[model samples]
Target: MSTLEIKDLHVSIDTEQGTKEILKGVTLTIKTGETHAIMGPNGSGKSTLASTIAGHPRYNVTSGSILLDGEDVLEMGVDERARAGLFLAMQYPVEVPGVTMTNFLRTAKTAIDGEAPSLRHWTKDVKAAMENLKIDADFANRNVNEGFSGGEKKRVEILQMELFKPKFAVLDETDSGLDVDALKVVSDGVNRAAEQNEMGTLLITHYTRILRYIKPDFVHVFVDGRIAEQGGPELADQLEDEGYDRFLVKA
Candidate 1:
């Protein structure tokens, strides 16, 4: 079984003058087929945590270990980590002006999976995933995220996730700026991908409404760059009722 283990992880971004720390000794674990929700307010190092795990070159891991199925992911490069079955759905997907969605997805599929998809099945699969996510069929022909709505961008990420079928996925604030209907569509895409692949996920978000649909197996309260509390599905209920105020006090 695939498992992602973070042990006393620390991350910092560099500046010309000196270094600044973001993630301070954070530790967590996600086993195969488990859905773990991490809740934190802004600047709590949530995105930093996800970026660090995916081996983002800009963020440096000062001290800690990232293990995938008992292997050290820190030793691997970004592509290596991705090919090893770790996926990050970024909070902000980049806009690739000249790269069409179909081309981008196909290239990523080929590079990570080590085989280009056959034309016969590739077109069919792409269309089916778009249909599932309610993305227009023409989205495939557009530049990657160049003219997408917030919801469309999230769905594009999920589409890549679906194509990759990574063993572990970290979804960063997939619920942001989405309308009720768009929210359902995005949540459904994530659910479908997880159910189809038994993919372990770490969903980072502020609102609990998404949880109403996704139903996390575990909910963690992150504050001051570390997890202050963690529990079963009930924790999400508590957050929904009380909010993060008590968590700040506890932290």
Candidate 2:
């Protein structure tokens, strides 16, 4: 089984004020089919961890080791990491003005798999996935996330996740701004990906509502630049009842 390991990760980013350290000695391990939820307040370096794992240019890893299935992932570039079975669903998916969803998804799938999928099966698969996600058929013709609502853009991200079928998926605040219905749809899609594809999930969110649907195997409470606490699903319930106030104090 594929395993993604983060050991003593330290990351920083350059701001106008100067370099700011975000993640300080964070360590975690996620194996295929395991869903690990990272719960934390804002500015706690949760997204930073996701971006770092996905090889985002903004976050600089001063020291740490990110390994995927015993291979050194920190050394791989962004596209290289994706090809190595790493997927990141951003909190705010960007718009690609000229790229159609069909073209973009096919191109990305081709890149990750090292060969283009068969056109007939590919088209059928895309349609089936879109239907399962409750996305309209016309969505394939639209430019990538162009003029779409927040929920629509998020759904498209899940669409890619379903199609690409990565070994590890880092979902950054996928529950953000989604309504109950939309949230259920997206959450169901994530569950499908995890169960069917056996994708290792690092779900980063502040609220436990999403956890109610996704049901993480482990919960890690991130504070300041480190993990302040971690436990089973019950920990999420505690956070919902008690809140992050105590964790903030520790931070």
Candidate 3:
């Protein structure tokens, strides 16, 4: 099975004030077919961890190693990372003004696989995925995420995840702004990918609501740029009941 390993990662970003550390000595390992949920309060560096893994240039890896199947992930560029099977569903997906959803998906698929998918098969797969996510077929003709609602953008994100079939997916606050129905729909897509592709998931969220649908094999509590605590799925229940007040008190 594939493995994504983070070893004592320290990430920082330059701000108007100065360079500020976000992830301080964070380490975690995810294997294919495993789901790892990272729960924490706001400003706890959960999103930073996700961005770092996806090779966002804004977050500098001050000192650490990110390895995917023993290859140096940090050495790869952003597109290279995607080609390496690392995927990130951003908290706020951006709009590509001129790129239609159909073209974007096909282009990305071609880039990752190094060959364009068969037009007939690709069209069928895209149609099936959009229907499963309840996305309107008209969205195929629209520009990527252009003028889409928050919920719609999120659905499109999951749609990309489903089509890409990455080995690991870092969903940064994917549950944010999603209503109950949309949450279930998105969660179902994630679960489907895991079952079908054995995709390892790094789910970052503050609420345990998503956990109810997308069960995590492991739960990590991030506070002050480090993992303050971790446990099984039971830990998420505790967080929901007790909240991060206890962890914040310590931080």
Worst 10 residues of 2 by lDDT: 242-251
Off by over 4 Å in 2: none
Q: In candidate 2, how many Å is residue 133 off?
A: 0.6
Q: lDDT per residue, candidate 3, 134-179, as tens digits?
A: 9999999999999999999999999999999999999999999999
- Total clashes for model 3: 0
- Order candidates by lDDT, high to low: 3, 2, 1
For candidate 3, what is the lDDT?
0.97
Per-candidate total of colliding backbone pairs: 0, 0, 0
Prediction 1 TM-score vs. true: 0.96
Between candidates 1 and 3, name the one with more favorable lDDT: 3
Q: What is the per-residue lDDT of model 2 for residues 139-213, given as tens digits with 9 covering 90 to 100?
A: 899999999999999999999999999999999999999999999999999999999999999999999999989
| Best-fitting candidate, scored by lDDT | 3
User: Could you tell me which 10 consecutive residues in candidate 3 have the lowest summed lDDT?
Assistant: 48-57
Q: Distance from true position, residue 243, model 1, in Å?
A: 1.6
* TM-scores, one per candidate: 0.96, 0.99, 0.99
